[model samples]
Target: MGGVNCLRSLVVLAIVCLMTLFVAQRHKGLTFYKIDAPVLIAHGGGGLPEATTSNSLEALQRSKAVGFCLIEVDFDLSNDEVQLDRKMKDGSPILRDDLSNLTPMTLADLVAWMAKNPTIRIVTDTKDSNEKLIARLSQTGLKEQLIVQVYQADQYQIARNAGFDTIILTLYQSTMSDDEILEFAKANRPFAVTIPRKRATNGNLPERLHEEGVQVLINTINDVWEGKAFLKRGISGFYSDTLMPKGTSSC
Candidate 1:
């Protein structure tokens, strides 16, 4: 009788554990594992001295060569055309070192590259027109390879509905208070939330988000030790210009 009771207790415990996992999975957006996994996302294809141009194809190649699987690209909408340009200070994203001329990549160019490199996933960032961009990328049939970053809380569902199962809610552009942000995160539960490095260091948002089963990523981290410190404070990953994972070297 004692043995039978012990077996029953084990079975009950297993059932509870499975239920907890199911709830957590349901709360997270689609492709939970993809976003929740701790990864070093190369910012602007990484910061190699020769290939430091932001969002350039050459930089992307260098980052890939360094064994980075996740890469972030910034896009801007101009005249109804999507182009890769993080900052348009000189009306040009970057000047080509080889050509000594300003050249930027188009959406079509990125799509073609993504088709060829199926293993590398892209994280998209834009100040505006995020839904439009998400819709456009979804139409390319590479939804699985794209991770959409929405600046607004309401844009979360819009992105998810656009066939982008993996969506990250980036908070840099938001005006919501920390409590409001936490409330929305608890309600909608995006795959992850990326905060500025200042926010991650100065507040308890990272720990609070982690408690809600939401992964947190900090941006523009260039130092590995800084990344390590945030990881200890509940940050799951970082968007870094040059910080690569252990065993990976940047060229």
Candidate 2:
């Protein structure tokens, strides 16, 4: 009986060591992306008030000031030449889809701003071709700070081929099975995947993704209760309008 008990203890110790090795390997795989988990990414630069509308320079600045290190901004081409958020009634360029007092900023403008604010990273929400977008960004020498959000597998490949180190495949409109999504992540090896908060809670998607060391980021979380709920569900981070209410802790 004494011998048997000693053998059982040895087995348990071996199993614990193996589990620790596995976890360390998984963490090393994620280290290539260089992102801190449970991050707060501002949606359209925090989607702040009229003085700092979405996708505007003011919005980006305000987001950084309020303790956000990552900001998502929209990008689209104007006449297939210049990159602008949208065009107004008079065909004047603007930073957001809705017309506002904030002036439109081109890709160059944003990159130059980022050069001055190196601590901030920008997530490019672009439906246009990655080749064109990358070409434009490369001119500014700030492409390393970009995280491209793509919809299609081909776009993911394009971003990778264009030498982007960080890429996210958005699953907001995906109807694929959980297995399919896992396979897609396995093949593409994106830095993260973004899904609507509703779908993020429905299945075992988050757990499966976590097992593979891929981070799961949910979109459009504006309140603290919902943010905490998702974080409790093992979500890696959020695309949020506000980081969290003042004096509130995300942990």
Candidate 3:
């Protein structure tokens, strides 16, 4: 009976190994052009000294002058229009802040800006209105320039169907286990995965994703040395507020 039980265990282990191999082989999802895109994403348009306000036109201009082609912007629905809005630490809305006295920027305004700057690709970070934003941007013939970030797995298909070829499955809003996350990346094949800094450093998640040919991006990094540390660990890049490549400056 002991011999029989041992034989069963061996068979089970073999089956599991085969299953793992099968899954790894299927990780090649559709490759978008941005897979080998820039290594640094200007967080909230970057250039802190020049552009004190994030998600503003001035911030974007400063970021562009800093030689960044990739910029991450937060979105929110306001007055039945998409606006560049990110809440402050004290929970005050960016547009309504008495201090900044900034004007609200609508989607139409952004589209015009995008048309002028042909090389810049916008990475969206919309909390709940990604579907609306994707549809709206797609209609404007900017589908190729938009890298939509989806919070859920099903949203990936939705974004793809909306004419977006590049999609990023950000892990900040997901509750999936590490193994499950890896499986999702292998199966769906998003252009990249955005991970919180803490989670990126926790385990071999970044390495595993790289093995599957999925690029990994860490969020909200500011220091130059910290970004280098993550890059050393095989992290593809960072969503940084101020960090930029060497010899590139807002000045």
Instruction: After superposing candidate 1 on the true structure, give the runs of residues whose Cα lies further than 4 Å from its correct spot.
Output: 1-37, 51-53, 86-103, 248-251
lDDT (Cα, tens digit) per residue for candidate 3, span 23-85: 776443211111222477877655455243358777787678767788888787645556777
The sequence of per-residue lDDT tens digits that candidate 1 reaches over residues 101-127 is 334567888899999898889999886
Q: How do the residues 55-162 of candidate 2 rate in per-residue lDDT, one tens digit apiece?
A: 777777667666677888877765665454664445455544443556567666776788888877888876566568766765667767888787766677777777
Worst 10 residues of 3 by lDDT: 28-37
TM-score of each: 0.76, 0.74, 0.76
Which should have the higher lDDT, number 1 or number 2? 1
lDDT of each: 0.76, 0.71, 0.74
Candidate achieving higher lDDT, 2 or 3: 3
Pairing residues by index, what is the TM-score of model 3? 0.76
In candidate 3, stretches whose alpha carbon ends up further than 4 angstroms from where it belongs are: 1-38, 50-53, 86-104, 247-251
TM-score of 1: 0.76
Which candidate ranks first by lDDT, i.e. highest?
A: 1
- Per-candidate clashes come to 0, 0, 0
